[model samples]
Target chain A: MTKYNLPVGPQHPALKEPASFWFKVEGEVIVDVDIRLGYNHRGIEKACESRNYIQCLYLLERICGICSHAHTTAFAQGVEEILGLEIPARAKYIRVIIAELERIHSHLLWLGVAGHEIGFDTLFMYAWRDRETVLDILELISGNRVNYAMNTIGGVRRDIDQAKREQILGMLDPLAERVKFYTDLVTSEPTCLARLENVAPVPADKAVALGTVGPTARASGIKVDVRRDDPYAAYAEIPFEVITSERGDLLGRAIVRLGEIGESVKIIKYALQNLPEGPLTVKAPRKVAAGEAVSRVEAPRGEDIHYVRADGSDHPERVKVRAPTLANLFAVGESMKGAYVADIPIVIASIDPCFSCTDRMIELVQSRTGTSSVMTWEELREYGIRWYGHGHRS
Target chain B: MCGQEQQRSDLARRDILAELCARFPGEVGEAAAPRPGRAWATVSREVLRPVTEFLLGCGPGAYLSTITAVDTGEEFQAIYHFWVAGTELNLRVRLDRREPAVPSIMDLHPGANFYEREIHDLMGIEVTGRGKLERLAVPDDWPEGHYPLRKDWPGLPGGESA
Candidate 1:
């Protein structure tokens, strides 16, 4: 049997970020996969080191475009903890609202990507089109779409007025109805289930042992949610159930995220109903005192932890971030082991891999011969054209 | 600063730190006072393996949460924050200024691969036994020896004003 290596992207159409997966395949089954990241490495951690407490918030938000609010919120919370400052009640409620909105947007994006991976164009279109509603709601509140600079050190930078609150509530009804319709379709639809069900089954024990977080762990029947376990923001006040599935497969993860969308709807409604009136942000000290603090938030992906140590300077002494994608990436490789080549993309997509957050550049070396081949983007494209069909057909 | 659950976590962490100190003797330095629901102890890089072993082996998989490095111009400090299933025993290991190197924990916990790589890239700390330490977060064309986090290192080209 001849062993062949297949390289997929630092620049592939399937991926949203720059990452390469070199797979050794025995006829169509992948024997082993070697992943290379860092192509999109913008030195985010380095950038954080240079920026002050306030500036770091904006920089961190850009870490992953989809989970921008999650990053900013976690970073701000860490700084706030170091300062020992309690955010205003109104700010807390607004933060929760934005966080839940970000979750809905992220899950919807993932669903659309998953649909696209499985050749379901209609599902992809529907998911993304509906996702625009959440984006619009976010824009109305924060004044921006992607990097909503709503978070500050002490509290939020923006406020939700009555008009904006009314607009958000009006949008929720149609949004929730559409989400429910899609959820039902995805669950009962034979084609969707056939591709996702039991494809990359990660057992409950394995998922926990491997430190999988977010919906990936929830799908594996783990009841651990950072929001529930270690309540932060207005999560303690808001009543919501943590969704989980015992199946521990691609479909299980999908179900957990989809169900959570309804829960987000419920949380947002509760927040709006009980929205308090007060100052949006408190006055933070210009110079941070010498202290260290850790903040963890349940991001759209999973647990996002930010560790900050300040040395009485505007700039942080040390800032450490552990994004959820870092944990789930390991599980992605584990899940791809027994899956078919055709199912590889879907299985990988199921983990909702965010290589942008965690990256290292590719260093290609021949498997059998041990010769290194540094292929450029154009050369890699040509190679794809030669092996697979024309770029469009593949 | 005092509560039933907080006190319990503090005591639990203290016991763990005391045991580690006794086990490592000179390697474990003076214990830092406990913070809210957390405790910390400083240790030399030599005792990192044993301390980690005791924590992860004796306890219920005191899962390694993160391995972070702080560059203080003159020296680089690598802090390994570990948390058990229930308790919080946050540990720290300080390395020398020059040639900051520590043994890789990939054999103990497979999840440490990326964390270690990140430390290597940003702090230029060598994880001694790790087969390959590729740049995890920095760009490929980034200048060598230009660790952005280091106190003395120059800022990025266009980053001064921003």
Candidate 2:
């Protein structure tokens, strides 16, 4: 069989983000894959150099629309560490509540995307419909759904009052029931199991070696979670179980994410119930002492790390963001080995690849015919669906 | 027993710093554990590979998180953030401003592939031993010798109007 190279999107029209994956396919099996990034670099790190710490907080928040709070909270924590400011207890609980809510929304969104990638439109529609409840809860707490803007330099900007807390608590029971349904559906549904089982299996050792994180890593039986390993905000006080699976395949990822939504609900409920009485924020100093600090948060996708250096000025000297997707992309590329070409979309979606947080660039190369033509992400997804539909009509 | 576990981790963290200091006598500098679960050490550029190899060999939980490069106006620095047994142990290496370069640790940690390329792209650092780092975050037409993250960068090569 002749080897033909297929390049899918730096545009990524389906995901509405920018990333390119060049697949070296031998007949139906993928021999190799090369990922090209950086089609959407906004130079936020360089921009952080000129702005004040408060200003940089909002700038970093825009790094990823899905995990905006995660980025801002990580940035705020790093600055607070440099300032030696411990946020108020109440503020910490609010952060946890909002963080868990964001996790729920993010995971639910991923479930839909994974469903869509596998050509399971019903699952996609159902997962997305359930996601709105999370969004509504987020809006109730933070006044916005996507970016939230809940985090500030010293602490959180919004507070979950008694009434709002009760409302949120009331909403959780139904959401939990919905998530339980998803858990059963993804695991037992023939459409899901057929597409996900034994596809793109990443063993435990390879997962660690390739630096996969969050659900991607957890599904591989690596007991590593930033929320568990390094407790931040109220995670130190809160008690929750770290979910893991030994499957290390696409099915394992679905199970792990679905399981995580349940955990997020529990964390949110606990934080709301134990809401302490204190100020929402502390008065942080404008000029931080000359020092550097690193802040890490387990975002919905994985571990999001931020580094901040203050030169005894209101403005930071340097700021660096290492979003979780960047750490996991290499492992994702490695996982593509021996996977059927039809399994490409779900495999890429399995890591919950967020290219807006970490973008890429690529030029399609015509390996065999010496002729090149661009194919949008949607086209590739449709091709996968059709190919799978023809062979296995599940 | 919880206290003993804490004590064990504390001692383990201390032992990591001790081992680094003992192995490379004059190379390791300004090492400290600011708080629990976070430790940072400044090492000379030459011993960076050996130090990373040592850390990765520590345990299964050890893995490189990401590499961050900073231009401190006086010199360039590359900080390698590694998570080992719940502690974030950062290895900082200083490079000369005129010709900044750091060795590649991709063979040990495959995750460092994009990070080292990123440092090369945004901060204008030469990542030696990593063959042909084809522009990870910059455009193909982006001018050479112009690093956006550098302190001395004068806002792209063109005039303000362009």
CAPRI level of candidate 2: medium
- lDDT of all the models against the reference? 0.75, 0.85
Worst 10-residue lDDT window, candidate 2 chain A: A355-364
Candidate 1, which CAPRI tier? acceptable
Candidate 1: give the TM-score of chain A: 0.89
Clashing pairs in 2: A37-A360, A37-A361, A38-A359, A38-A360, A39-A360
Model 1 lDDT tens row, B1-162: 133244234223335666667787877665763444355778877767777777776543346767878876567888786655443455677778777899987777776777888788777888987797877667767777766666676666667434
Task: Give the alpha carbon lDDT tens digit for every residue of A211-293 in model 2.
Answer: 98999999999878888788899988887877899999999998999899998999899898999998999999988889999
Please, what are the lDDT tens digits per residue for candidate 1 over residues A181-286? 9889889886677777787798876775566788998999876677765678988778888889999988998899999999999999999999999999898987
Give candidate 2 regions above 4 Å deviation: A13-17, A354-366, A392-394, B1-15, B160-162
The number of the candidate with the highest TM-score is 2
Clashing pairs in 1: A37-A360, A38-A359, A38-A360
Model 1 interface RMSD over true interface Cα atoms: 5.8
